[model samples]
Target: MTDVVSYPKGDLRRMLSVLAALESMPEATLVKLVAKTGLDKKTVSNLIIQAGEQAGVQISKSGPIYKLENWGPVIKRSGAKMALTGALNAPIVLA
Candidate 1:
């Protein structure tokens, strides 16, 4: 996905990083997202919102845990994982 699009950099990259992290686990908390992406709480929070609104990623929150139900409009689950894998030059893991 990202290989086909050169636009996913900077904040977009960060958002993808967030998505990648979320995709790696069944559910994650804000602290876990911050830890996994090395992003602050606010940034992770905003990215999650952006992913849900703009990208159509279905992220359901239950208390502090966030679960990624759909990969959203930008890409599919496998594509997002592969894209982030290429972007980081490593596999994305949150657990």
Candidate 2:
């Protein structure tokens, strides 16, 4: 048997992007897309779970696959108010 290795640093923002990308793809391709993040597999997996929770998204894992649940509504509401008000076009930063 070989010892397992893990990624030391994880970026939640990157994980969120990965989740958004996966939302439009088939479940079977999750692992492949996550791998492209260049994070250790286990690290990426855990980050996915944590990010999902923070965003009020549900996630499940079976064997090597991870799935998101009810993420659409959560994503839709995230910036809806800002979008409607054209906040995205304004140059504003939170302090």
Candidate 3:
């Protein structure tokens, strides 16, 4: 079985960046997210889907545009933005 605990820190940061971008940008597309997060197209796409499914964020797409519908039950907008903005300032450890 794959080890969830061994997920890379870079990936975590990338995921957070993607979520942060969506939180800040109302009309974000895959391309915009990639540019904002410094991640590639495929990586952004995968992370966006992962964010929607695991992070409890509702993301809807119309044509080529993506929108953040609402902050779902699992994660809050301010909290995520805070973490991304270095308010937490602590290493993230997954156990």
The TM-score of predicted model 3 comes to 0.75
Give the best candidate by lDDT: 1
Q: List the residue pairs that clash in candidate 3.
A: none
Better of 1 and 3 by TM-score: 3
For candidate 2, give the lDDT of residue 26: 59
TM-score versus the correct structure, for each prediction: 0.72, 0.49, 0.75
For all candidates in order, the CA lDDT equals 0.73, 0.52, 0.71
Residue 2, model 3: lDDT of 25
Evaluated against the true structure, the overall lDDT of model 3 is 0.71
Sorted on lDDT, best first, the list reads 1, 3, 2
Question: How far out, in Å, is residue 64 in model 1?
Answer: 0.5
> Which candidate, 2 or 3, has the higher lDDT?
3
Which of the numbered candidates is closest to the native, going by highest TM-score? 3
